[model samples]
Target: MISLQEENDLIDQILGGKQEAYARLVDNYKSYAYTIALKILNNRPEAEEAAQDGFIKAYQYLKSFNRKARFSTWLYRIIFNTAISYKRKNRVQMESIEHNDRGEESRESDLERSDKEVFIARAMEHLNEADRLAIQLYYIKEFSLDEVAEMMGQRVNTLKVRVHRARQRLADELTKILKEEALTL
Candidate 1:
């Protein structure tokens, strides 16, 4: 925890508007801030955004920082909160793009989506690397079940179970979240 005296000193310097001091603050806190943001947003671009946003917010709220807590702890919470908001905003945008439009064109044209694979990276973070690889191979990369089995070094039946279980777990989690939200509303 930064002492009241230290915090006061930093705030005095910041309030005096030492741009270099502010940059030093950001540099000091950025790694942990970015990690917290990434855990929520899971997208590099969004993580970067949340980290940057958190820094700006920290600058704006510097005076409000509690001396009892570590400066990094307060900054971490802000970064986390910002990342959650960023994720929520992005989920809506992704859903919009995911919807099938009624006026679809040729199959080849249908294959060309405006939203890129970057969105999938965020969803993939919900799974472990193994589950993520299985999902990518089965869905995104278009590998056959046998190929997936070979890649995973598991029996075909085992691979099938893993895929099925992964899908079920994801659906169950989403359903639970939706139900909780519906109750809140």
Candidate 2:
């Protein structure tokens, strides 16, 4: 992670006609931006496009970025908004395909973990979009509550409540799912 001073210097260089400085910023934030987009769009291709578009938009609007907030927070907000827009525009639901390339060393444990992941994913599907986003940003992405709130454009307290409620709902759903699975065993 770049220090705040370094980030500011890069922003200054970008604003002063040193366009290459922007690449550093993009490199620093691209994975995070793509993750945010993936969380929203759930499609790898669309998420990648949205992250790129967000970077372009950020570059275009860089001059207007007041130094009040961290550049990352600002850039992530742009990424989040861009991804949301893409999600709205593409209303068609697409399932994400993930490839597992683990060797045979831990197949049994991997299967157990995969089963748990499927159950948790099913429980996550029960959450409303906002709650799901809030929880994912706060927990899965390991963003601070304040950062997640700012990115989501919600008050910190509101986001905290959303996260709490979402966790409760997930727990309930998981328990129900486990019970059903147990009955079938």
Candidate 3:
């Protein structure tokens, strides 16, 4: 594997005149970029999109990247920031409306919701942004719980509780929806 310094040097070369050098850089860092995007966005198509955007940005801003950081590290930060911005901009920020106490169907039918988000993702949608992010970082993104806690800016125990509760809520909601669907048929 090429060292990050080597990669940065290569990028400098590419910007200098060896434009074909972009191919090598792309081959080297594309997957890493995509994974970071996926981790942030959770949608494969959106991940691909953010990855493409990051590559373009990297190319356009290659001159702006000082040699202070490792190439991959800087690239990772670019994709991470881009993915986060893209998600925030694209996401439908649901208001936390109170569960209607008197309107069972409203709440129950709402409970029937399932996002096209994967198994973990559908469950994740139930959580508010904080809980969803905590759960994704700790579980799906496979960050250590401690790492997740740090990233989420919360106590480790609090992150643990959030992950646990998020999972439970997802399970309960999925089961309820599945059972309802079965009865409807």
The C-alpha local distance difference test score for the whole of candidate 3 amounts to 0.70
What's the TM-score of each model vs. the native? 0.49, 0.87, 0.55
Candidate 2: residue 181 lDDT (0-100): 99
Candidate 1: Cα lDDT at 119: 31
Residue range 6-90, candidate 1, lDDT tens digits: 6567767997877566776677667766765665554567789889998999889987877776565566657756776787788
Instruction: For model 3, state the Cα shift of residue 183 in Å.
Output: 19
lDDT of 2 at 45: 83
CA RMSD, predictions in order: 15.7, 5.1, 7.8
- For model 3, the run of ten residues with the poorest summed lDDT: 93-102
lDDT of 2 by residue, 48-134 (tens): 999999999999999999899888889999999999999877664322222232233235445767888878877998999999999
- Judge candidate 1 at residue 44 and give its lDDT: 68
TM-score of 3: 0.55
TM-score of 1: 0.49
- Checking candidate 1 for backbone clashes, the offending pairs are none
- Give the better candidate number (1 or 2) by TM-score: 2
Q: What's the candidate order when arranged by decreasing lDDT?
A: 2, 3, 1
lDDT of 1 at 136: 47
Selected candidate, larger lDDT, 1 vs 2: 2
Regions of candidate 2 where Cα sits further than 4 Å from its true position: 92-113
